[model samples]
Target chain A: MATLAAVIASTHHPFYYKASTAPPEERPPFADEWVAKITAFRETLTRARADVLVMVGSDHFHQLWLDNMPQFLVGKAPFYDANWYNEEREFGLPRMLLRGHEELSSHILRGGLDEGFDLAFSNELRIDHSITCPIITLRPEADLPIVPIYTNIFAPPLPRPARFVELGHAIRRLIDTWPSDLRVAVIGTGHLSLELGGPRQFGPHGPDPEFDRKAVEWIASGDIERALAEVTLDSLWTPGNATHGFMDFMLMMGVAGEGAKADYADSLDLFHTMEAYFTWYPNGVPA
Target chain B: MSKYLLNKFLFTVDRDPDLVERYRSAPHETVAWWESTIANEILNCHGGEASTWLTFDDVEREALAGHDYVKLFELGAHPFLTLTLFIAMFERDYEEPLAFQKEYAARLSHFSLPYPDIAT
Candidate 1:
């Protein structure tokens, strides 16, 4: 049976790439260090010899927009193209014609549907900063086959964080059902607090470090129920509208299972953005 | 105008290019459409006057940037969507919409810097 080997979640802000190119004097002190940490995380993946990577993040109107936005989507594409570079020059990402795991994605899509998720499956999808930044930061080589799961937390009326937890369990069931001797890693990519536009359009109103610190403590406690009870959706959004990205973190908590410690946590404030990286492992799950 | 009216008008213009083109090419007809389509409905939602002639220049000057856009931001338009609308309009006149959008957003954005770095 396939085994869930690791679960990781982190911020995927475009500013990280911007910070990478900044002059040493102009750049934040921790920018380069955080990049190094992500690289180290990738080394851990390589050491674990993971067979497939399941990437979960939100779409930022790159491909899906107001006309047609689904709350939850799964990639069914056999081959996924990395096209952020074509649309925006700032990314500085090398284009990748990457492969997707059709079998694993199909199973997860079916399982999610059966588990009462109003899931939308797409064979035609575009990879944006949310999905692309992690690979660029952690796995620039883009060697691993990825299964992209999208949550429409970018806009309002997003799925309750509780639903994200349920989706994580559905993914676990999909892994157990697979008979192949595979090592699967689930990755959640997003940010801690972000407010794209509004009254604070140019003012720092997020990356509420206090909220983030408490939230991480909750995750590290390995108490999903407590986290769910305390870190309510309103509380997350109270920090900033962009904090809804925590839905991805909730998914990671669900998959890491009860007693999953946030063995590693790094919170960095880049410019005005609040970003963090975390690695959580299920109790008894191997490297 | 109410928050919903401004957001709904801008949302339609952002999502539909035909409306934008119409607003650009034929102001009176666009104003008519705005009156019948958006202004009438949204003003009814507010129980306010819905008779103003909304013109192309009014959209570009007031709705897009001038007073109404600022008011929309104040009235609680989704910040990300607000930036996206600016990017969409920037794409109309500029060569690099993303660059302009980012620069503009950065200027307006306030940062929460100088946090304690996480120990290795």
Candidate 2:
């Protein structure tokens, strides 16, 4: 059986790529601190030495559209082309291609279906920054085979926050039960009190600093009950229009398990959004 | 209220470098041409199998043609779509980083929370 090496969750701040890699003259003043934090966060994954990764992220109307949008979809292909043109245009994210773990993808699809997930599968998926940002941040070599799971955080009539958590729990079960010796890490990224394309956008701090602060506590402490009690589809709008992305973190909390404290947790306060990182070692942290 | 069509205009045009340029420089013409020639075409499908009933309403057409992002947001055309495409077109006009984004926020600052429902 596969080992669940690590369970990780983070905020996928699209600006990090540009902010960290820009020429010294062009770089933002916060870039150094941001890079230092990410480097430390990256070490958590490196220490786990995961062989396969299950990446959870939401599509920003990239491949998935309002027309025929799937609430939850899994990528089960041999190869996945990553990032998109607008990502390059808007965030300076590089185009990427990633290998897929088909056998595990098949297992998850079958197991998820049997578990009543009604999982959507795509043979050819061109992933966007939601999935790629973590790869860039945690595993920049982008060398490991991955199974990409995309949730619909953009469109409305979306799966409620609980559904995302349920799927995460299911994914953890499926990965653990897969008939392979591969060491697997499940990494998911979301936003914290983000207000994109809204009146509060591009502010000095995330639109709702209070919400971001409380959210960090819930995730770091694995307080799923409080998170679920406080978060709802409508309530999410209060923090910021784009705060629905926080549900992805709630999903990661499910993978980490209720009351399962993250072994490694860190955050950086930045403009428009807060950058957060958490990693859990279910089998104890590697020495 | 074809909010879907409104978003489709942003979605399709933003992805194509040529269309982003065309829409940026020639808003009225691009909207008109899109309405007539491309609006009905179903994305990710055979061209002959176009969607015939997806035309934008009068308000949607003008809001897009006039580049009224504020109106588009009011009409629930998906703010992310509106913002991404707008940045692609207009970000270059600003001298400082995020000047356009901050301007965008200020422009819509009058609106309070319990925002317009974005459900399509």
Candidate 3:
């Protein structure tokens, strides 16, 4: 029974690979700062000795398609490598640590339903950047095995806010039922606000400060359910195609529970269009 | 054709105070702004019954005549507002609309909207 550590979303842009390899000085301040933050965050995870991670992010069209998109899909591979960033860069994952984690997938599928999430399990699926970026960012050493979960937040007819919260509880239940004696961490990626594409794309890289302030206040106070409920497409995301990805942020709150607090948060510039943050669930709380 | 179209349109307007204010203060001008700024591609792809809910008044029709679908959908109050309109449009008969909705989603995912977290 592996323990669940983090439920994070992939906050990297789809063009991150092309962007990241550019010389640091030539990159935008936001991108450069993010790489540093990601590197530091990974070091913290290593220090915490987190043994297993349950990463939650949405896929673009890598594995599931519109014709057969499941609301929830869990990766069941014993050893899966990320296709876009890692493979293209010749970066190697810690394959030895990844060897024996199949049961975690079964446990999540079984437990998720008990908490009311209709999760689909896939063994042969390959992981894309959404799942891979956070892993590589937090654990460049790949010392721990990860259970990747993909949500259909980006497509039309996305799951409602309340349903996403339910999925979080389902993940908690899945972690509690795992047979392993390991500790876990969950990471949720995506924006506090601001959609990445279309006209909303024109200016405003940082999110609406008042909204971000309210969200932080809500999380610090431990009223997670309310925080989740307060988020809507218009208020929390950009108006166009940009709104789809923010659903992953709501799902992260579900996994983090009421007690988790934001360890770090910052809004960046490029139009002040981007935001990045992290939340951690301390060990004392029961899953 | 159904009264639901008007209900859905008004319901959308009522829910978004900003748009309601704009419509009340300057209806024709607001309509023009919507025509120019919205993404018609999204409207054509996901609009479904929303196209009918629109009143197509002479001025609005003239403004929107050559507009793209995505732009038309963007003119609505919010993404969710537009989304719900589509949902309501299909909610009655349900089945066929759902299949269309699914196909529409697949197409959207192809353009990089589906995966926000992956490093490109």
Q: For each of the candidates, what fraction of the native contacts does it recover?
A: 0.25, 0.92, 0.00
Model 2 alpha-carbon drift over 4 Å, by segment: none
lDDT tens readout by residue for model 1, B59-102: 43355434233444544555555565555454456664235544
Native-to-model Cα distance after best TM-score fit, residue A18 in candidate 1, in Å: 3.6
Per DockQ, what order, best first? 2, 1, 3
Per-residue lDDT of A210 in model 2:
98
* Model 1 CAPRI rating: incorrect
lDDT of 2: 0.93
Better of 1 and 3 by TM-score: 1
Least accurate 10 contiguous residues by lDDT in model 2 chain B: B46-55
Chain B TM-scores, listed for every candidate in order, come to: 0.50, 0.96, 0.30
Error at A111, model 2, angstroms: 0.3
DockQ of 1: 0.16
Whichever of 1 and 2 has more TM-score, that candidate is 2
Note the DockQ of each predicted structure. Answer: 0.16, 0.91, 0.03
TM-score of 1: 0.75
Q: Write the per-residue lDDT of candidate 2 for residues A180-205, one digit (tens) a residue.
A: 99999999999999998889999999
lDDT of 1 by residue, A1-287 (tens): 88776777878877666567668886766777877776776665555567888999887656665535688999999888865532254345556676899988888888888889878988978777788787777677788899999997765657787888888878877787777788888888866666565333333434466777777676666578887887666676566657778778788788777666776666655545666777755434354
By lDDT, the better pick of 1 and 2 is 2
Error of 1 at A241 (Å): 1.7
**How well docked is model 2, in DockQ terms?**
0.91
